[model samples]
Target chain A: MQLISAACWSTYRIFVAYILSLAFGIFYGVSANVSPKREKFMIALLDVLQSVPILGFFPVAIAFFAAVFQGQRIGLELAAIFLIFTSQAWNIAFGVYETIKTLPREFGEVSKAFNFGPDFTVRRVYLPAMIPTIVFNSGVSMANGWYFLMASEIISLGNKQVKLPGLGSTMMSYLAQGNIWGVIASIGTIVLINALLQIFIFRPLVRWSELFQYNATGSAPEWPTVVDVLSGLGRALRIDTFLVSLVSLGNRAYGKVAKYVIYGIGTIVAAAVGYLLYWLFTPPYPWDILVQIPTALTVTAMRVIAAVVISVLLALPFVIRSVRNVQTAQNIYSLASILGSIPAVIFYPPIVALGGRSYMELLSILLLLTGSFWYALFNMSKGAMLLPGVLTEMSQVFNIKGWLYYKNVLIPAILPPLITGALTAWGGAWNASIVAEHVQFGDQVYSIPGIGSLLTEATSNTKALVLTVLCMTVLIVLVNMLFWRPWYSRSAEKYNITE
Target chain B: MALLDIKNLNLTFRENGKELTVLENINFSLNEGEFLCLVGPSGSGKSTILRIVSGILNQYTGEVLYKDQPNPQPNPNVSMVFQSFALIPWLTVQENIELVLEARGINPRQRVRTALKYIDMVGLDSFEDAYPRELSGGMKQRVGIARALAVEPEILLMDEPFSALDVLTAADLREQVVNLWQEKKLPLKSVLMVTHNMEEAVFLADRIIVLSARPAHIMGEVSVDLPRPRDSRDKAFEDILDKVYSMILSSRLGK
Candidate 1:
């Protein structure tokens, strides 16, 4: 019963946050596109915010919202929703903005000649244009959000944990009690809920929104039963026109002054980030334990770099095979993902039984591969399969064969999605490292001296967790600024198809 | 008296704080039952002048009077056909027409009744339920024309409406447009079309206004005196096409 209510609360919280995020993301995205200045600063700001890991801010959110709502349940719920918003909103905003920016020049003239008002444009133009991308990104964001959901539901500040009623808390408690079956049950529940959300929400939406895609081709799949019922409800209620009227009203409300109001929002967010930085450096409460976060970060960074290199080397053959025979590769990919989801911790006991003949760091590296490597395998194979037929034929036509063909013709073609997959895979490894570097399976332990272990040990103290997480965040910001941003821009400039 | 009139039109666009005039010294008027074609070389701003007249563009020094009234903002009655068709793909053909009716504050049931006539006129009666993506290029332009005609505008503005189509499709769509005009089935009176096809202008237009290269001004005007179902092989039609060809070519060199 407690589990049920927790699930309900999670659903309600997501619903509220989803609607608000979708609205604001789409609005701000279109605004950024249409606004004369292009809002490049605003776009950069969103990118930086996305790198600030949600779990890292638990101490700040819990303390701030707990006080603001006077220690209320609603306050904690709001805090969790805000954390989910951080994961969910940015890509949706970027997706909408990018879609709007890519709209044909004639569409702009059509809008002008037709005199499409802000309200009509939102309903008829922007909303329709962005829905496909928004649906896709939401699926991705939801997957990431579940990882943070586990961290958020049970906020452990100085070991005085405030447990929320959710699958996340249920899983945590079950895991702590060493009841593997109960943890499995909770995992099953979460997966079932996620599947239901996908089938009813994403599948139907993804299918429906495909019509709005600029390069839309082929027949759309049949609508799910949920869509049929919903469309019936909509028709009975005359919902489409009614929603248009409502949106236009909202549009009229924001007329002329919307940009200034948006500017005010950007300022508030900048100030909030500054304040959080200040608090992180000078925590009001001191930690009992000392954590050498910089050293830990370096240790983890080296491990991550190694994991990324190894994964690419191993995953390359599969991608190459997929480039030849796409059908078999698709089958292999789906099968592999299903097998991969069986957690690495499940096999830790057997691996540990083999003893010090194999290195402990190798065990952690293997565990990291379980969590991160599959993303690259899946994305790279898909990317390779999608390589244009003409590209391959042209290589043959030009007498380019063997490794030379792959090096000159294929490598640059697959680089964009390959890089994207690696970036996300590295991020997943960073998150999974908190578990990967230290493993406890069936009374057996295999530990490594890395930032994950540092974070795990710091969990017992409030200030240390905050300070350590803050240090990791600062390191991330620096890496993104000096390395990732430049690499991403350059890769896109060189390899990405312009038209 | 003219159905629509423009005088002393001058337009400039600022890029990196540098002002470049796009159109200048544009003067023209449309009579109640005339088909006017504005033809020129690419980048000659014939489309800009049309955009200015339709009230879609406001940053210009000009007199754009509709029936001699100086009203600004997009004139609801001044509808346009775009080169790309520009149909909202998410909406069905029927709903696309109904959307205009709804904007005009027509009742729901009545909107369907009014939309059907234009859809039938465009010969898309069977395709009212189809989306734009499902339609052919020629069929999509029919929707674009139907949509413009749906508003019951006094004058229609087409900005290179047939440029994106293949030669065969363009020819078919052109005949249908001239058929609609000749049959006098619709409320529309005059059309101000933007095109670069010298032959097409001679074929469809009552008066072809040739524009000079950018900072575009009226360079020459030729009035086609040929009858309906114009034959390109006829000496009279050939002469008209030849004259339009020279006017546009000379202007291109004059730039």
Candidate 2:
């Protein structure tokens, strides 16, 4: 009964966060793509924010919300939801932005030809076009939410720790008590929830989203027999029809109230920002923490680089095999996704126990690898799938083989996706760094010297925490602007394979 | 003996637990010094035949013989031009041609020389350094032709080479292809092309093999027997076009 309620609480948190993420993603993505001038700023801002690790927001969440609600449970609950929101939102938003940006000009022209009003265009054209991207990203986002579940639910403000009643907190408590059976049970519960979500939600939605794809090739992969049978059962029960009608009814109601809702949200956001800015300016800031940032960032950056390098090396063999065989690609892809959805934090107790204080640094790196490696693996596998049929045929017909094939064809084909994966992996490494560099179990606090540890240490002091997060964000934004942005655009332009 | 022979070719695709027969009993041969066009309606597995012959596809049950031997492997003596002009976007026109040469183990110096020679033949002379994205659709196809010709293959396989181009560009490139084939400036033995356009088939092929719609098989072969610089305005060309059109239409209607 305890496990069931804890699972339900975790599910509730993830569900609410996902809903918020979907709304924010669509609004932000559409607005970014709609205006040319705003696109540059919005995209740039998203890039910076995306690089900021989810844990970086913990301080702000604690200081602002805790103060607003006078340390009430509602405040902490909102903070946890906001933390999960941070993990899930950016990717979905980026997905939406990309889908809107790349939507065939014909769609816009058709809408204009009919003189579609803003509401009509969004309802009939843009939203439907975004469904596939949103659905796919939703799976990734949910996985991320699960990965960060423990950290979000259990917050440390100053000396007092606020623990929410969820699977994450339950597991943490189990680890603290050294209860092996309870830990195993928690892990089992998580896996069950993940599997249920995959079967009931993601699989069906993925099949449904095919209808919204701009040039849907109708070559969707076949689901397993069980999924087919379940979906068939759904159809027989008229569940799909009922859901469609419910969604349509909601859409109609939303359309009528959307203008007022937008205005209301705008005003609230403006007021919050104004108040936050005032609070920010009247501060006794941590000046010493600012000086330590560059050195700490360098240390953290080195670990991130190490993690990304190892991930690429590990992902390469799978990517090469995947490019050669579709079956291998699909199998590896599904297996990796399942493994990736398991939170890296769950292994911390066992890993920490095994490694002990002597091997803490190595263990930290290992944990970082678990968190970040899948981005590289997933993106490279997806890139392999997108290898243009004509290009592959070109290689085969020419008898291009071995090293030569990798150089001229395969490498160039996967470069853009590899870069994209590495960029995300880089961010994931930074996010994982917080939990990795510093770990807490029972009454023991394990520590390492890095930006992650620095941020974790500063959590007791809100001013110091805010300062560390700010400095870290600045460093991340700088790295993205200087290194990743140029690399991404260059490869995307040069290595693009089109049929 | 024919340079390339596809005997009793059949291809079946299994989709969603159902067997879809795309081609059946496709028997054809490419003779030396001949221009043959396999003309059919779209989705008639005409392109699949090109793919099989080129050794990009091999799941089919049949023998594609090169030099009267069962050639399961891609033959070095055979090269293909894609409808989409599948040039590597990153590689310059020169590099694109050289890539295949490099694959064939031609040394660096000879690779450049051969690439340039073909580039000149296709009139893409100074444009060798330009990327595919920089080239016009007609020019991109020229590079495609040049890349195929650079391999100095005895048999050139073109899959709807002009279909993706505008009508005017297609007409212009069609003339160039004919000139290249007729002039015999390269070490060319024969040409096999797959096209859905009946007029394109009549315009290009010395002999046109008409294929029926799906589960496609050779309907009939029409010998052009026409002279060089063949004009579409010519009554002979129209008559051949009309015959090929009726053959395709009659089969489609029959299905």
| Per-model TM-score on C-alpha atoms | 0.83, 0.61
Off by over 4 Å in 1: A1-24, A34-38, A69-72, A199-201, A220-223, A231-295, A306-426, A438-450, A454-468, A481-499, B16-21
The DockQ figures for the candidates are 0.46, 0.01
- Write one digit per residue (lDDT tens) for candidate 2, span B118-158: 89988989998876766788998999898888878888989
**Local distance difference test, per candidate?**
0.74, 0.80
Model 1 DockQ class: acceptable
Candidate 1 residues A1-499, lDDT tens each?
7667767766666667776677667666766755444467667667666666555665677788888997788888878788767756775777677677767676667667777766666666766777666765565556545545666677653447687787777766776677878777766666667667755666666567657755444453455677788679978987556655654543443465865776688799889878866876674554433436667899998887778778777888888888746465545454443344334444454465465425778777776776568667766775676677778888889999889987887888888767766765676666566666766555666677777777777776666776777677777777767777678668867976433
Residue B47 in model 1: shift from native, Å? 2.9
Per-residue lDDT for A199-259 in model 2, tens only? Answer: 6666666665554554333234344565567569967986445433433443443464865
DockQ of 2: 0.01
Q: Is the docking of candidate 2 incorrect, acceptable, medium or high quality?
A: incorrect
| Candidate closest to the true structure, highest lDDT | 2
- RMSD of model 1 against the true structure: 4.7
- Colliding residue pairs in candidate 2: none
